[model samples]
Target: MICVTLGRGRHRTLLEEWGQAAEAGAELVELRIDCLRSEINLKRLLTDRRTPIVFTVRRGADGGLWRGNEEKRLLLLREAIVTGVEYVDLELDIAKSIPRFGKTKRIVSYHNFRETPADLDTIAEQAREANADVVKIATMAKSVADASRILEAAARSSEKVPTVGIAMGPLGVFTRVLGRKFGAPFTFAGFNPERIFAPGMLQFDELRRDYGYERINAQTEVYAVLGDPIAHSLSPAVHNAAFQKLGINAVYVPLLIPNGKLRDSLDLLSWLDIKGMSVTIPHKEAILPMLRQADGAVDRLKACNTVVIKDKVWTGHNTDYHAAMGVLEEAYGGATSDEVSVLMDKQVLILGAGGVARTIAYGLSRRGAGVAITNRDDERAARVAAEVGCRHISWAARASTPCDILINGTPVGMHPNVDESPVPPAAFRAGMVVFDTIYHPENTMFLKLARERECRTISGVDMFVRQAALQFTLFTGKNAPDDLMRQVVARKLGVTRD
Candidate 1:
């Protein structure tokens, strides 16, 4: 079941927001009365309810806004219960003091802001001993193992009473969606993406539309993209749309795996039966040691961006190399033999020395192109150049040397910073090729300046779509719907076809 949590200061029109949640298929609406600026009028909010309502007046100690005295808070909850609400959420500390009203079940809740305690079963037993009709536990997760503990606790305690367990943060998002499969009666979500009350609350539309929450069961397959700062990824949108189009019983989510935790995170993948994953950023190189088998491309590039799991073994592959080289070859199509030979020896200058930069440089060098690397930190640039058998150029001298192709492998022109460019406009020359690896702002400042100089330009969307299509094929063993994947990504990024 999906429960939409509503807090004050997030919505100007409370009733309208509640109505919209109901229309969006919310099974329950939780009204956080403590978040209100003034006293709530129970009759006004409770009348004509389309779905069951849960009244929660949480105190400040439990990560709530209620600052009033305990007596007044209990009185307010009692009044709400009298209004015929379906449930009243009472923290475990005050559960015994508050008298339950007829037909209004009490949900005894416990929250730990620091970490998941080792004595989780003892805590659930304590809530049950306090006469709770339902038990809810939410704890902050410092690692993926913390979330695994919470899921185990919830599954073990469900026989005693209906339970809701959540690991709160980006590191625990997988638990929030997988809770229901582990015997959780319901999972909570924010009314909308912008008005979230918890750290890792899923958006209502994402649970309903992207995950197909109602249809998800134990047999459904799970997939995710692992990275740090993964909130802005569009992979979920593209992959979920493909699954829906193909009628596959699978769900894809974003997993924020911090550095040094790839091995631990992969351990949980087998425990949870995750079928596939897309690796990005720092993890592309870090995940190689954890794989049981890898493709030839991964061995050549020393990086893997896609991993497929079967019979508890992980096989890694490099889709970025294929994607980058394919786009470059297509852009130089129909050229004369002399021009083609020039491309074979094209002077390619790359920005940044990260995973993506390494992949591009290796692919180009193998094709017999002369590649140069430049970065803000000259040491890192020299390291990458040495690894790829290319020359390292100082950042200050990048513009003095001319190149046939300039590629921005950095995140300078990514979303929310669309005006920033890694290279100066003077670096762009007429008839030169300029490419950026940021797909969100389809037109970055670098691309704009390159176009004005009459240089042939390519957006990162082409590379992103091609690589994602390859990952899809690897996961499903079927021909990917390339056209549909392009359309979904373009629509999400608000890029219109010319």
Candidate 2:
């Protein structure tokens, strides 16, 4: 079940939104009385409550907006309990003071905006000892390990008492979706996606539609995309949709593991029994060495974008290599029996010398295509070109260099930066095949220019879906719903094409 948190300054607005939340399929709502500008009118708000509510009167210290005295805050909590609110959220320090009354259950919660405390188990026990019917722990998670620690504590405490463990921020999203597996009764979500009720609080619709949170249970296998700056990833939506379509009992989430923290997160990810993961950005190459064993793609590209764990062993694979080759082949007029010979003698110019760039360069090089790499950082471009046995092209000379195909491995034309293009307009010649690996905006400025120049275009959507579909198969050992995966990604990206 998902609880929608509603915080409005006016009672009328609050009541209207409460009904709206119900209409939107909210099973529960949290009435944050602390946000009211006027005096509290418990009877007026509770009279015709449309859904079960977790009544909360928060103070500033606990990431709430209440600016009144503690005495008044405590009085409001007690009054709500006396008025028979379904649940009341009391902070750990004051949980003992609020006596349990009637049928109102006590949700003793702890909120630390700074960091997840080291003694989370001790805090959970304290909430339990304070007569909490449900213990809620919300803290700022600095790393994946911090989120893991909160999850571990919740799993342990739930065996004895019901516990809701949440680590705030993008890194902690897993806990909210996977908390039920650790025995949380229900997780909190914001009624409005645009509102900032709490850091990292997912909107009700997002949890329901994108994550399929209601379907998650202890038995549901967990998979996630791990990387830094993971906020824009559409992998979760794509994979989760495929899981639902294929009737696979699993959930995929986005985890922001910043650079230098991947090694530390390995044990924690294993501890959570994550069945698989999709690695992105900086970690792709970093993860290659950590794998117990890897496929030929990983060995050749020196990068691992997919990982499947079994019996505590992590096996890595590079789905990007195959996905890129497949899409490029199809765009180049379908694959042949000798796929490697298709691109032979063709000159390919690749933009950005990152992981994706490296993968494409190696694939093209292996297929006997002449490849040249260019980046804003000339040194990195030169280094990658040397590693892939490809020639280096200066950023200044990229547009003038003659090539039959253009591959954008950089994020230069991704969402929000949709107007930016790595290559100049003159670079796109007629009959050239242009491919942009940034999928968020299906038609990037780079692709648009290429189209205007009469070049055959391939958007990142095709590659992303193909790669994610491959990951789905690796995760479940089942043929992926390719059409469904493409549709989900296209719909989320607001594009009509596959």
Q: Which candidate should be chosen as best, given TM-score against the real structure?
A: 2
Per-residue lDDT of model 1, residues 151-195, tens digit only:
778878887787888999888887888777666777888976567
Q: What is the C-alpha lDDT of each candidate?
A: 0.84, 0.89
Tell me which residue pairs clash in candidate 1: none
* Candidate 1 lDDT for residue 399: 77
Q: How would you encode candidate 2's per-residue C-alpha lDDT over 1-498 as one tens digit per residue?
A: 899999999999989999999999998899998899988888899988899989999889999999889999999899889988889999999999888999999999999999999999999999999999999999999888899999899889898889999999889987888998779999999877667777888878888988999899889988999998897688998899989998889999998888988888876777777889999877998887678989999988788999998887889999999999889878766656765557777899999998889889999999889999999999999999999999998999999999999999998977788899998899989999999998878889999999999999988888988998899889999999999888878777773223
lDDT of 1: 0.84
Residue 456's lDDT within candidate 2 is 95
Give me the runs in candidate 1 sitting further than 4 Å from their true place.
Answer: 9-12, 96-102, 129-133, 192-194, 334-343, 491-498
**Pairs in steric clash, model 2:** none
